[model samples]
Target: MNQQALVDVAAVSAPCQGALHWVGMEQIALPLRVAGQTIAGRAAAGVNLVDPLARGIHMSRLYLALAGLDNQELSLVRVASVLETFLESHRELSNAAFLDLSGEALLNRPALISPLSGWKTYPFTLRCRRDEHGLQAILELTVGYSSTCPCSAALARQLIQQAFDERFTDTPVTHDGVREWLGGEQGIVATPHSQRSQAHLSIRLANGLDDLPLAAFVDRIESALGTALQTAVKRIDEQAFALANGQNLMFCEDAARRLHQALRGQAGIEGFRLRVVHAESLHAHDAVARSEWNWAGS
Candidate 1:
């Protein structure tokens, strides 16, 4: 059977010629290799329509450009190359390219005081822009940790002190007896409130880096927070975790400041902004604090 050939309208001239800043697809489902893990991701890929006389950009070309991500590990290098592919596919039609990939990355984490390990999922997004002049990439991810309110800790200590005074009003206070009392259930009459908190980090990476510093950043934040969420736990791990919480009490502002200071010392990051959200245990609303550094021009 013979069939008529369909005309390609996208190849024709526009009725009203006008340039478009960006022409592409958003939330395209894809599987990408990132940091040795295959992550299921959604990508937004596009380029500018520089040619005003052209009817439109070839959307299929932008879609095809995403195929490169499947083979290469997701990083600034991959982002730069894929963006270049987007512009090359629509050579005359585009001068600038943009790509955004969002997915969850899995990391295997060891328990604090046990010989067990488990996987933790971190939501991550990579965004990039490329043009004739230069290229830029940004990574955003979140870390979940525990935050014990400093004010709450102090109030709890005061209540314990009052309880101690009431219990031994007519007795002599000795260091051994006080230590015994602290080791007993009666010592901890009041406990401070702590809740699961999160730190969201957005960092601009230096150009031409070989790999994404995701693991390093996670380590940095977790170390600074000192009480990252664990997937598996034993009695020893729980006790160690309670000890860690006692040592690393912080407010939302402290969490933000710790991240800001730590990220500033990193080598591959040019700038960063961090938001710390403490899901308050004592109140109905969450406490949030934001900190940023070296992003004035960006």
Candidate 2:
């Protein structure tokens, strides 16, 4: 018997005619290389269908083109190439291509005052868009930290002072006695409220960058916050973290401002939008503040 040709429905004209802004696959499972490690990742790959009369662009071509990312380390420059391949394959059909790759980036972070360290995961998504203006990449990630409320700290201090005045009314001030009292629970009437906080950063990259700069950016943001959440700690490290929180009390506004300052002048970054969220311990709701630089107009 003679074989018949298979039909391609996607190649046929659509009864309803209009071009699509985005069309392809989402929630695709893929393995990605980040920081020299193979981390499981999910992706959404697509291209713009400029042909209003055509049914669709070649989706299989986009899926197959993603294979190029499997063997190589992920980076803006590298991803740009894959997008170029996507455009080349859909040369006559699509005028733009996009790839959105998401995964958790893991790095073993050392304790504040100990030899111990533990793995920390930063959830991140990288997006690459290629159009007539050329390729542009956007990196978004979340970094967790500890934020002690400044207002709470001030109120706690006032209560502590009131308690001290009442307790020391009759006793003469002595260094050892005062120190002992300060060490006791009665002397330290209250402590400031603190909560685990997160900074969500979306950064646009300048041209000619080779890597994503995830690790470096993580370190910088954590250092600027000064109270990054710790893992695998000794008693000494715990004490140090406590001290850090006490000394570095801030509101969401402070955190947002700090991140903005830290990200400024960072090499390879053109613009960014950052949001700091403080999950309020005293209230049921969260407090958020946002800031952007070189991004408002763009």
Candidate 3:
């Protein structure tokens, strides 16, 4: 006699009720690729499963769908597509879905006046929403740069001038003499405070094109703000940094406005929100400014 094979299937439960909320599946890890580089990311997903009668949602499907993602094909487009898939898989229960991807993006930067190079990592985030209208994508990028306090720089200059005056009261001190005095043990009386700064930029894209040169954008921002952070520093690099700080002395407001201008002029950016935070070395609190651009026509 032939034995019958047993088949098992999950029992379908009743639908849930009005305005049910389902939130979980935080910190799901996956590999991603952006701007031609592969990076690891932990994506968080949440959705509102609204069924008038069901007891719970199918949580395992969300993890399985995210785990099935291919790192090589990971892009803004892919992310949005996956989010839609998540919504559709539970279309009967969920009316909207929200997905967020967080990870570190690395880049190689060359040192100033030196042949050496180093790597820099910036935190990146991308969020998407699936609703009745369609899909919307948002890109958030964080970049680090250096900022010199304008007040400190001015004070340093004043102190240097006073030192020169004190040294050459009887006779005018030559440039060499001033340089020597400033380079001596008591030469330059004071130095300005420069601190590592961070800029958080969030852009709303019209499409799912994640191919934007995020690293290059970061470089442009650092250069536009006039203070690219240094990984490996030598004497020359330090001098170069001092000069940069002196020239690009800016307050937190100025930095935010400058970043806003850059983002507004950048092509393919429909709209953007910029937040610049300068960690002040002189004080315990940080200075921050925020700016937003509205692209009505686009």
Candidate 4:
């Protein structure tokens, strides 16, 4: 069959004449480069309908243009090329192009104090646009961790001290006796509450940037928080994790501040924004906080 002989309704004029800001396909299943590796992902590809009288865009043109991403590592430069091809393919119908890619990346993480390591999945999205304002991109991802509430830790410690005072007021307190008591429920009556938490980060990249700093960002943020959630663990790893929680208890504010400072020191980007969420074990509601640096726009 002659492809051009088939009906092409998109070539016909629209009954109503008006410009549409965006028009194209969304949630297109595709393979994406994430953290320097290829992963199964979905992409939303579109372009602005600048020509008001045009019935619709050449949707096939845009879909075919996505072939540029195949086997290519995702980067701002690579995305710009595909977007440029969108405008070139629709030289008269469109002036702007947009692409959004979403995927989950699995990274191997070592246990806190054990030789065991396991895979951790980080969900991420990369949004790209080419318009009169020039090329723009935003990299966003979520990292999970554990947060021990500082207030809860303090209150639990106070209760333990009170219990000790009541029991040892007349008894001679020795190291062995204190150790035995601490190992029992009577001395360490209450325990602080902790919850699995997550941090959401969005970074605006410089136009000339070549690679996404996802792995680096994950490492820095996890280090700053000091209690990244573990994937596999032994009894020793669990003990080490407990020690870490006890030593680095924080509120939502502290987690956000730590991430803010950590992101401030990073490069290859113009600005960043972060949010930390603590799923509270003590209450039904979650604790959330947000922070940003130079996030207004470029």
Which prediction has the highest lDDT against the true structure?
2
Candidate 3 structure, TM-score to reference: 0.86
Question: Per-residue lDDT of 1-298 in model 1, one digit per residue for the tens?
Answer: 8899988988788999999998889989999776678889999988888899999888888898788888467777777877888887888788999999999888889999899999998899988889886898889999999999889999999999998998788879999989998889998899999999999999998877868888888998899889999878899999999999999999898889888888988888999988999999999999999989877876
Structural similarity to truth (TM-score) of each candidate: 0.94, 0.96, 0.86, 0.94
Q: Please provide, for model 3 over 1-298, each residue's C-alpha lDDT reduced to its tens digit, 9 standing for 90 to 100.
A: 9998764232345443355665547888878776556788888887786776655566777777786555664566666667777887787778788888888887777878777778888898877787887777777899988888888889988998887788789977689877777789677888889888999988887664665457667867887898888887778887887788888988898899889888877766779888889998889999999988883432
Checking candidate 1 for backbone clashes, the offending pairs are none
lDDT of 3 at 118: 85
Query: Across residues 1-298, which tens digit of lDDT does each residue of candidate 4 receive?
Result: 6466777777889999999999999988888776667789888999999899999888888899999888577777778889999999988899999999888977889998889999888999989999999989998999999999999999999999999999899999999999999998798999999999999999898768877777888899899999999989999999999999998899999999999988888787689888899999999999999999999854
The per-prediction CA RMSD against the true structure, in angstroms, equals 1.7, 1.3, 3.5, 1.9
How accurate locally is residue 138 in candidate 4, as Cα lDDT from 0 to 100? 92
Error of 3 at 246 (Å): 1.5
Kindly report which residue stretches of model 4 are placed more than 4 angstroms away from their true locations once superposed.
1-4
lDDT of every predicted structure (CA atoms): 0.88, 0.92, 0.78, 0.89
Candidate 4, position 286, lDDT: 96
Q: Considering only N, C-alpha and C atoms within 3 Å, which residue pairs clash in candidate 2?
A: none
Q: Residue by residue across 151-232, what tens digits does model 2's lDDT show?
A: 9999999999999899888989899989999999899989999999999999998878878899999999999999999989
